[model samples]
Target: MSSPTHSANTGRIILHIGTGSFHRAHQAWYLHRLRESGNEHALDWSIAAGNIRSDMNPTHEALAAQNGMYTLETVTPDGVRAYEHIRSIQHVLPWSPDHAPLIECGASRTCRIISFTVTESGYYLDSRDRLDVSHPDIAADLDGARTTIYGVLAAILDARRRADGGPVTLQCCDNLRHNGEKFRAGFAEFLERRNLAELKRWVDEHTTTPSAMVDRITPRPTPDIRPHVLAATGFDDRCPVMGESFAQWVIEDDFIAGRPAWESAGAELVDSVLPYEEAKIRILNATHSCIAWAGTLAGFEYIHEGTGDAEIARFAGDYITQDVIPSLLPSPVDLPRYRDVVLERFGNPDIRDTNERVAADGFTKLSGFIVPTLRDCFARGASPSATALLPALFLAFLARWADGTLRIPYRDSLLDHQEIRAMLASEDPVAVFCADRRVWGELASDSRLVEAVRTASHSVNLWLAARHGVHNRK
Candidate 1:
């Protein structure tokens, strides 16, 4: 198949640099819809997709063969429907040794925004929430006299600086709380380490990193489903994307280089995104972790299947409402409504959000999404009985993976393997669970919570052993 040529579009070009399925189904689809509403001229937006990983070549070829357009299968409660000709993207750039084109695209006068959905690990932050310069790729970039933190951004900024252009908005659509602030801190740290204080100052003064809340359930496409996707889309897309019908993007209005009246494109541009971020992170993401770990151990595959079980669903809902929501810092949220919405989203049979997929990256994910709720529960003098089980379940999941009962492809392969091995090799699972300062941070030393987690870990271990007849087999 021949690669598609870039079409001329009058909108401000938007570059989305990620190979993940979620980016294609969620962000790219949103831009496609915005363009379809006769706003393409006004928005002047087109997406040039790129991936940093070498394994993404197949996806790049498929997307390019389809002319930078494909189908989005949205499975909603009502029904499943295919959206064709979702034409927001203009081209795909496979991983390359030279990133000059990507740098040039981002620095172009016409390119107003750059969005990323690279998973949590993509940020390459250390435990201290600073850039991890020791990362192999980061070291290579630095060795080549390029700035770390994805040298493309720095290169673009340099190009823009040369052109005397204003800074572009760097929008992050990741799952991190205060994601914008985290990116700013990481970028600043990266600059400081390289003695680029002047460029750092320019970024601080000219750029805007807006906090955003993005929600969607996009699963990796399996071989069995590839044919269905091709049939529905009429394209041989190797990495066609699938997602739930529900989607949302809430952003704080803080763009410096100006942006598409994304509000005009159906995005909610609010004066403050803190409330939305808090609600989604604490309620949505926290509950997701609970469901993932607990449901996986309970022998459930997809979220809808697990949530379909009354007991498991109720446990998750109650944990969020009774323990997690009340512990949040801001004023109380509508726990009942949020729980209902979560259950509904979870029950969307079309979503097919797998437990194993969600359960991946337990180490980093637990600290960011689950630990805060656990800590908050402790602060409010509340029992984290149900909330505490989440970490225990995660530990068990890691243990299972370590014992070769399950397998997952992790982004930080070395760190994940080492952590899992260490946990598995520990004399007492409880001690290892409680003493891991990196995993639990300061909460590791809290006697009360430590005991609670230790007890929970023991129970989970025993339960798994008994349920799976490990003892009898031994």
Candidate 2:
């Protein structure tokens, strides 16, 4: 690990275990803003961030070379752009296969909050919220491998307990619905499965996982950003991050170990993050995926392209106004205005958020983002046609991928490659997909769900045909 440029202080540390673009653009940005404000509470907090995996080795190297400093380029929907030098991360731990440095930092009493941003599928949870013990990663983690979150956290917490390190909060900065709760459950189960009853008890008594809702349309950092940052900011930052100007973080105020005054930096420390998370997951995230899948089918590369199309926008708008808002009635959030704002953000051309980025992990999104609205609509005796279109679009997108016709390589962490191929070869592909319990949970057996998905799939095919000026399918 490289020493930070800024002098070390007596401030407590936030050991964040992901140095990806989203983490830099969102969480690290918030801390940067907080520190820049010169608030006394904020000054007492700092971030020591690193990745659990070596996939981000280049980014880590760049950050370490620059003393954990980077430039953040933020653009608005109207093409307005701004750059800021972010210096919130004071430590950039080098990547290691054994995760020794990360575990050491996380085990320290100075590390009051151990936050992480593994993607949604990284949790390894099944439809019923149980840890997917059958997954090879989860299985390996159970037997002392430190690859997955469960594996890493288990090692960290056990070390912390052994060191007599004080209590710490385990904050999950992911898109999973009820993310903190789900993570805590999985972590507890992981310990129990390992038969580490002492460590499990200590964690249960000491740690607090507050659910949070984080939103920012941060694309994977493109090469164009580096030159722009250099020209604008006079800094040749190698690891510049970019995102839309719109960002929101609503966290449940349940931190056990003291936390920073993030509210001063535009973060909402709410009593309950339920409404905020539901709105984000269902309205924004699900709609984002809808546009991505639809845009990809229409041969569009960017999310802005899909959101710009009238028919595609209508599909997304109707999903929000008709199904999502209805299900989330009595929410404190302004459903209509929020829906409009979300769509506008999606239409931001400068962000350059790709269809492939938003469309990855369709299996997880099917259950996490789309199915809740479907189930709610069914319970209320209302049609979920708009919501159903998301899965339908995904169905079309998946077909393209299976047939080797997709323009971009589809990456799904939870995708079963061989199973998908077999399903495509089967006589009734749509039926087989609709029946997948992993995506639909118990709703897979519901005839209404089957019909809605089937109808929506037909509509999607027709829409694709019209876009290409071809005849409709039988």
Candidate 3:
């Protein structure tokens, strides 16, 4: 088969600025499938890659060498299906301090849509969901007259405004609830603070940040899978992606300039994505967090191994179906069906998602993904069960780092293990860990929840004592 090319004949451009694996496997692959399914008009959508991080140099090289194409392997229980011509990307912007090209793309008349999977922390928002102007990088971006927010996005929006562009659809593919709204709010907050009232007004009039719910178990590439991906595609792409067969993108149709009939591209465009967002975040994401920390502490490496352990699996399932779901108001979701899907996805052996990877960043993951669900349960006066244990396990995980029992595998990142170690060594580790007003926010003082977490930590300590004879150092 010939390599796929963007159907430029239709005169539409789809700019994906992030080069992360999730972007490739989920959004880019979806666009590829849309083109293959005879959506020729949609095929005109082209993706120009952009990245700000210094580490993306090798990724840019590998992707450019392959003509901006790579293989997407979807592993299922039935078998593995691989697509060779997964070509939604048209060009990649070289990682440079000057982001003029990115800005121009966003402002282009032909570019009606912009999409992103820049993870949870990318927005640069403080705990209160406001833009964190205090962040050194954010301050630098602002001071330098950088066009992009967070370096890349602000430039794109700036270019769009200069081009006399109409409202451009801003689709956020992150895991946060009302994610699009959050992005817009953050941008607006920055504008207001910087006294760019005029630009803020322009944005308010022109852009639409549509809330979206996206899910897929895209695991970070491992050493073992890298060779397989290379052999399969005959290219040595260092950042190959691996994911489960399942994928979903539920978005609200609140675009400004226009949008790809993303619906035509297998994305569900809804009137309101709030319910879907809540359902996925509370059930899928929250349960994933539970399994991650719980499974890791139990010595299970992969999600499949974690699920195979009856006690851990039961704890996960019960926490979601029983405790988490019931706490929601006027629950329109089918919890049982959701649980089944989560189970099958977690058991996808080919994905090889590590518990340790998911278990990292428990501070952010717990507060954003899991704690809200716990809060809802408490608000509804529900009993604490396995759901209550989520935070407990997270606290224990943090506590373990103090004793050097757990080590963060990722290279130098924001999550300071030394700070975590110091916090754990304090007179009251749980209190100290929870006292980081930035992290716990107001939840730091929730007496009932705090007590439950303390109890759970005690249980973990006892379990450790019993297993490894008191001074267990595993």
Residue-wise C-alpha lDDT for candidate 3, range 1-474, written one tens digit per residue: 112254332367766767887888888888777877787576667777766665666877778777678766667744575634577787666666676656666677777787777787778877678887877767876775553444466667666787786677777888777898899888777777666667778877887888988877777766755677677777665557776778888888887766666787678888988877877877787777778777777767787787776767887888877777676656556777878888777877777778877777677767777777777777778766667678777777666656667644532144676776777778987777656655666677677766777886787667655645633654
Off by over 4 Å in 3: 1-10, 77-81, 94-96, 145-151, 223-240, 329-332, 407-447, 454-474
Scored by CA lDDT, what does every candidate get? 0.72, 0.90, 0.72
Which candidate model has the greater lDDT, 1 or 2?
A: 2
Residue 433 of candidate 2: its Cα lDDT? Answer: 86
Against the true structure, whose TM-score is highest?
Answer: 2
TM-score of each: 0.84, 0.90, 0.85
Q: Top model by lDDT, which number?
A: 2
Pick the winner on lDDT between candidates 2 and 3: 2
Off by over 4 Å in 2: 1-9, 398-433, 470-474
| Shift in Å, residue 211, candidate 2 | 1.2
lDDT score, residue 88, model 2? 89
Q: Tell me how far the alpha carbon of residue 421 in candidate 1 is from the true structure, in angstroms, after superposition.
A: 6.3
Worst 10 residues of 3 by lDDT: 1-10
lDDT, model 3: 0.72
What is candidate 1's lDDT per residue for 1-474, written digit by digit as tens? 124344433446777777577887777877777777776464466787776555667777777777777766677765666655567778675556566656767767766787887787778887777788888867766555443345667776777777776678888888777788898888777667667667788888878899888888777766755687767766665556777778878888998767766676677888878777777876787677777777777677877787887656766776787777677645434666766887888888777777867776677667777788888788878888877777777777766667776544333332556766876797876677677777788888678777877777887777676757953685
Q: Could you report the Cα RMSD, in angstroms, for every candidate shown?
A: 4.1, 3.2, 4.0
